[model samples]
Target chain A: MTASPPQTGGPWRATGTVAALVVGGLGLALLGLLLGRADVSVLGAPLVLGLVWAALTRPTEPGEVVVEGAHQDPDSARVRASVRLEPPAGSELALLRVGSPSHRTVDVAVAAPRSRTVGVSVSGVRTGRQRFFSVVHRETSVGQVVGTAAIRAGPVTLTVLPRTRPLGHLPLPPRLQGLTGSHDSRRVGDGGDLHDIAPFTPGDRLRRIDWRVTLRESGRGARPGSLTDLHVRRSLATADAVVTLVLDSRDDIGRDISTWSGYAELHPEEATSLDIAREAAASIAKAYLEAGDRVGVVDLGHHHRPLRPAGGRRHLLRVMHTLATATPSGRARPVVRPPQVPSGALLIVFSTFLDDQASGLAATWCRHGHRVLAVDVLPPLDRGRATTGERNVYRVVDIARADRLWELERAGVETVAWHELAGDERTLAIGLAARARQRSRPR
Target chain B: MSVADRARRASASARVALFAERLVATARIWSPSKSRPLPRVVADIGPWVPVWLVTAVTAGVAVASAAIVTRGTVPWAIVLATIAITVAQPDGPGAGIFAVTIGVLLVASGTEPFAWPLYVLLATVHLVVVLSALTSGLPRRARFELALLVAPGRRFLAVQAVAQPLALLGAVVTGAGVTLPWLPVAAGLGLVVLAWRLDVRVGDDGDG
Candidate 1:
């Protein structure tokens, strides 16, 4: 990042106070001499002496201030700005102001010869690019500000990444592809989970044989069985599942519908529906990736940036970074063609469901034989303080939205409200059961 | 008590309670803690320049009126105008003009010593004018940062405090009809220079 040149003018000139004191003192002294009033001259002496001393000692060289830690963690990023002067012995005062109108300004003061670093702690309230620092320095005294220089440290940008929450075990897709992973594949292989026991074949190893079952079979009730009647324990094969996250970032509305009108331009400090979607998507991606599943993200808002399904901790970080930069753009509409999904991948669509586009897309994915789960990211409404007319209007809207969700369910798409799933463990169990039933049904 | 009497007493108590609540509400509305509605007259004054100008005029008028009332002279009008100008523009030249005007007014009034309170008030007005003009052009954020620098600023104020008293003492001596010799004045000037040099040396050492 290139630093902008310092802005210097106006206040950089000698302050009016200094000029007034110096001229006033000399003028009074001359007048006193003319009038033969020794007391008046005596009174002017101090002003003269003070201004002279201040002028002789004023700082001349321009100082440099460099602001560090411009990029900070969204949760707790502390920015420190340090200033250095060419002649450090000057008895001038330095002042630092950091932040823009979107955030509260932080003020710091440092005395010359012992100027300390100024630190500002920022809370990750608003995300995206923001101005971090703007500094101004002044060489001032008690009576006058002698010189001033504004550090034009160009626009300092700070990007705040979205905060992630920890999600527990998530249901995976029915189809498993990778050779080595954590999920049970139901095929016999060398694994810990027992699948079944069968008669020993020619290729079966000695360690696989169940000796107790073999011995019982050999000594059958007063009759000796043949040595050929042996059995072996078989273990199920495990493979990795594929999960693709679809994010609908068309509109981010908070719980309060009244603020939704202007919310697009000026988002409230509270996490909006989009923020919830980002956090939820990030958590789900982390959980599945850690479980040895391939996770990918498709931005419904910007189709140009799509992350293909891949598995690893590094891939999880990439998905999170992409989610942090996800912003609501363009008009809300259903995808013309369903996004390419890995065959039989569990498609999780995170959206507010204010419009039918996200629901339609989820239904489309379900039709393509993908296990599509629609997460309703809208916050619960509170109509207790609303007027009768407002309540009636909202009630009508709610009924219409409920019918849309019902239609999605009828289309074999499992719809889950984000708040219900977040608060209740039972809701996740129900979702898991629904996924199981859908997977068991013949296609 | 009869039912009717009890009911009437209850209604009266309710009325008293209602009255008290209304009184408290009115007090809150008029309280200083609540921001006063800005007058429409000042709604369009965007910058602090006009505010500082008004302040300077007010302080100048107060000082000039006090000087006139104490000295009983009309020539103080020049001093008042000069002070107003100085307050409005608080530059070196304006301050010089104001000082000259004050000196000429005193001389014209025949050195009949003004009250010490009046002199102190004049000094305060001058200080206010100078400080206001100096800070008039600063942005609101910069002003806040400058306020944070007050601790270090006290050092400069301390030096001024030490220097100004000596001037005051000299004035007191002269006013008491004492013919102050040049040697002590020279010595005082020398002492001021010495103190300034010592301060500079200390600052240099601190930096090192």
Candidate 2:
């Protein structure tokens, strides 16, 4: 991100005011020399000195810089910023510029005198990625004198990404025309070759009963050239299944309602979006444990790390650790490759589908033979399409999303488009489940 | 630049900037009410005290010195009376001023030169104490204390500078009666204020 220019013009100008006072004093002293009877040039010296004193004594203006950002976990999200006396320090007081619910200002002083970086914490908002644009500082030095300026404008947007959830239900392809032994049911069917069996019971049929058995028991000769009849049970062998979840949090959601302060928190510093994702992934793992499915996550936002597919509780913890501290790579932070789909498992992608790269990645996963499930997260109100141009952009995004949805459908994968979840989780979830089953039908 | 040179420059610049900002902020953040309280009559005594005790002590010394004195009821009497009253009263510039004013008045009214010289010496000592307190090395507190002596006439100057022409309109109704003794009262008030500053419990004295 490009750094903002530093602000100037504060108590620095006190010297000018003092210089004016000095000039006045010098003028007075010259008058004293011209008019007084005794030689008074020496008196003028003191007067000149006083002028210098005033000029030198003028107060300095305040210097300040503001830094705002947001963070999220699977459970919640936070947006916050703080202003401080910029480096090459000259002021102590820092102000917070929070937009909306009436612009609120909070004053902060560094306990370590001129501290440049101060930690800010916002809890109990939501569990998702949050972003802040800029920070402003109003600094004062001499008296109530003030100098207003922008300290830092973050071109690199910060993101608090949504956390992941592990596999809840892992299903096997019941019937496939190509595959034979493993997935297909063998109970009372006529597909695979069989072995020997035991004697007949009440439910056994007499057809051929192995006419040899009847003949042997009744001293009858062999009726036909076949073996005795019997029923057998078939058990199919288990196979590995890989399910990938790609989460894209590229849309700007926190626009109109950016931050809310003083929300009572049970744990003052609650988990952010990444934290929630970690826990969610772990919970999903627990759900999949008995179902016998392995899980993995794809981080589509800007991050220090790359795509990670893990299994068991240990893997979930690893994902959680990354989510807790992942910062959006602003434009400069390198582009990340979406995680590759593992063989045999379904790919379930969770993303807002606003950014082209993210949407493109989802489509790529589907084409690669992965059972892709692209979960489209509705962008927040601020990120909502506004101008005709933006609406058009949204239209393009919607069309792209629709195309991907169809692409996944053609690829025999499920696709779920959802709003902010808590409001209508049940219907949307049930619909997604139904779609999952429908997509599972044999082609 | 070399690492050492860069580091040195960074450190020094940081120091200069911090020092400059502190001085500027200190100069502006001044409060006077939080300053010493003096010049008021009720200020001298603490709560729940007897008024007669104060009067008796002040009057007793005046009477004693008047009755037995080589220099008669002039400077000696006032000097003796001052010492006695100052000790009986609270410790402050006001008490000192009260003692000296009474002593000087007696001297000017015909006390011996020797007796009056003592009063002059005491007055000079009082002035020195006040000046020293002002330049007491504490930035904010020192400046405020210094204002008492240097700008003693600040209020008077303000009125004359801004209100004299305005005062004429009130003359018809209030007469010249208002401005008469006010100058002396203000000066007296200034002295009383000096007293209050001395009364302040600065170090670990714990006395108000």
For each candidate in turn, the TM-score is 0.69, 0.36
Reference-based lDDT, residue A157, model 2: 39
Q: Deviation in angstroms for B23 in model 2?
A: 52
lDDT of each: 0.59, 0.38
Per-residue error (Å), model 2, residue A319: 3.5
| TM-score of the second chain for every model | 0.40, 0.21
Best by lDDT: 1
**Model 1 lDDT tens row, B30-148:** 44123222211001111112234435454655475347533554565666666566555544456556655665665665654433432443344344434443443343323222222
| Clash pairs, model 1 backbone | A4-A154, A6-A152, A19-B92, A20-B92
Give residue A114's lDDT in candidate 1 (0 to 100).
40
Q: What is the TM-score of chain A alone in each candidate?
A: 0.81, 0.44
Give DockQ for candidates 1 onward, in order: 0.14, 0.02
Query: How many angstroms is residue B26 displaced in model 2 relative to the true structure, after the best TM-score fit?
Result: 48
**Taking the tens digit of each residue's C-alpha lDDT, what string does model 2 give over B129-192?**
2222122211221112111222212222232222222322333343423334344345445655
Q: Considering summed lDDT, which 10 consecutive residues are worst modelled in model 1 chain A?
A: A79-88
Tell me the TM-score of model 2.
0.36
Name the 10 consecutive residues with the lowest summed lDDT in model 2 chain B: B37-46
TM-score of 1: 0.69
